[model samples]
Structures are given as C-alpha cells and as structure tokens.
Target: MTEVCFVGDADCDLQYELLSRETAREALSTYDLRRPFENAIALSTVSLGAAVSLCNDLNWYVVRFVDDVLVREPSVDDDEWLSRELATAVRDGDVTGPDTGEYLKVYGLEEPEPTPEDPNPKGPPALVEPLYVSRQDGAVPEYDLRDVDDTVVVRLTEGEFTV
Candidate 1:
C-alpha cells in the first residue's frame, strides 16, 4: 500500500492559501461527485483529483491543498478540525505528532523551511505560529500526545513493501 500524509508547504513562491476544515470538506464533497475513485492509486490520486476539482471550482488558477500537501501560501481556517487533530495528536502523542527530529530520522522527511530542498520530507514541524485555531482565547496547546515526553514512529507496511 502507498503511504499518505497531511504534508503541506504554506509559503511557496506561487502564493496560494490553505483552506479551513469546512472548506476542505466542501471541496472533498465536490471532488467526490466529480471524479470516481479507482483502486489503482486510491489515496494519492483521489486527493489530487479533489484538489484539482476545488481549484477549478474556485478559479484560483493554481495548485494547493491536494491530498496531504499544502502548496503556496496556505492559510488554514481558524476552526478547521485537522488543526485540532494535529494539536490533539501532538498533545496526545500520536505518531504524526511532535518529535521533529525523530520524525525526520524515521521517514526521511523534513520540516517546512524558508528554502526547503525537500517539501515532502519524512519529518515535519509539530507547531507553527498563526495557525488560526478557533478557540484563540485559551492558551493554545501544542503537542499534547499521550506521552508528551516520549518519541515514536508509526508506519504502515505490507508484503513486498519494507522500509
């Protein structure tokens, strides 16, 4: 099976923005209706197709938020659930949570950078500023995983696929 991630690049040269969860959901819905999912490349293709559909709908004339990618100047909505999920994962110690160094070591990914050689690195930064969380009043939380102190890596593998 192919691996899928919520990887993104917010400040690329192209200058696109991230969408809130609700907007993304709407995009997903439109994508679902526009394209029929196939088994050949389920996750990756579907995400790309949906993103393209959304772009076509909005007339953005660019690429952004396809699959687990965030190309261009992505600005997520304050009330998006994925943001919360990421926060919870970090706080609850999920696999894709914090531990930037460890994430890089395992997946060969890199956190976002001003001039990144690899946009889709194995590891990514856990917390970013100006995230636009809905409940901005409360002290915004970061990396509240099960063991905030521990570091871990979780991968999905199948026959003939070893990393």
Candidate 2:
C-alpha cells in the first residue's frame, strides 16, 4: 500500500501529537509525498519551498515549483552526496549544514502521470483536494487509494492519524 501522512495547522505543543501519528496513522496518512528518485521532487507548500531554498543554497539544480509540486534538476555532476545532504537539511531545517557540503542530488522525478487537464504540466496536481468536512457524517466521500503509483498517502483519524 502507498504510505502517506498529513500535516495540519498546529501550535508548538500540538506538533508533538501530530508527529505521533507519523507511524500510527494508516499506511496512508493525510500527507502525500512523492519518491525523491524520479529526478528529488518536493510536492507540498512547505517541502516545495524547502527544495527551492536547498537548491539555491547548495547551487544544486534549479528547483522548480509548478503548483504544489517542486522539481530540482541537479546542476552539477555526481550530486548523490548533495541530494542526501539536502534531504538532511530539509529534515533538520537547515539548508546548508556544516556536515553536509553545498550540493544536492537530482534523484527525485520531475513528471508523474498526467491528468487530462494539466497537459505537459510541470508537476502533478495537488494530492488532497480541499477537505469537505461535513457536520452530518453520512455523506463523507471516500477514496480507495489502492492503485496510486510512486506515492505515499497517509490516512486520517478522529482528528488524529492511526498509522
């Protein structure tokens, strides 16, 4: 099954509870992240920005953001170390770490399957459509998420992630 996670607006204390869901939330949490090998693509608002800043800081590839997707094509050769460093930077909230040199890899993919509307699109459309919260519960929509490719999507719980 595709793995996923979700991130919501949370305060400092709330962040802890949120992280707890990282492993427990359904195999597919609310967050939908793409594999960083098709070309190190970032596909969310925060991650996209992180990718761009990482590229600029490390002189890696030019990170491109088309809608919610972010793409970085390594500008230099042998960017394996660079990519790993960038990933660390992103995880640690540092673009240029003392341990990680100024470089990034071009491992993430640039193009995913194309939807009819976004032809030759720079990136795939948003993973989660606007949430349709319903006070009345019976009409909630559902998605099977059985056949998605190269993606990890987390499921949601009673205001939490189950893993």
lDDT of each: 0.27, 0.30
RMSD of each: 16.2, 18.2
Q: Per-residue lDDT tens digits of candidate 2, residues 41-89?
A: 3333244344444334423112221112223223221222223334434
TM-scores vs. true structure, each candidate: 0.20, 0.19
Cα deviation of 5, candidate 1, in Å: 6.7
lDDT of 1 at 21: 40
Candidate 1 residue-wise lDDT, 114-158, digit = tens? 436766544224322221111223333333333232222321212
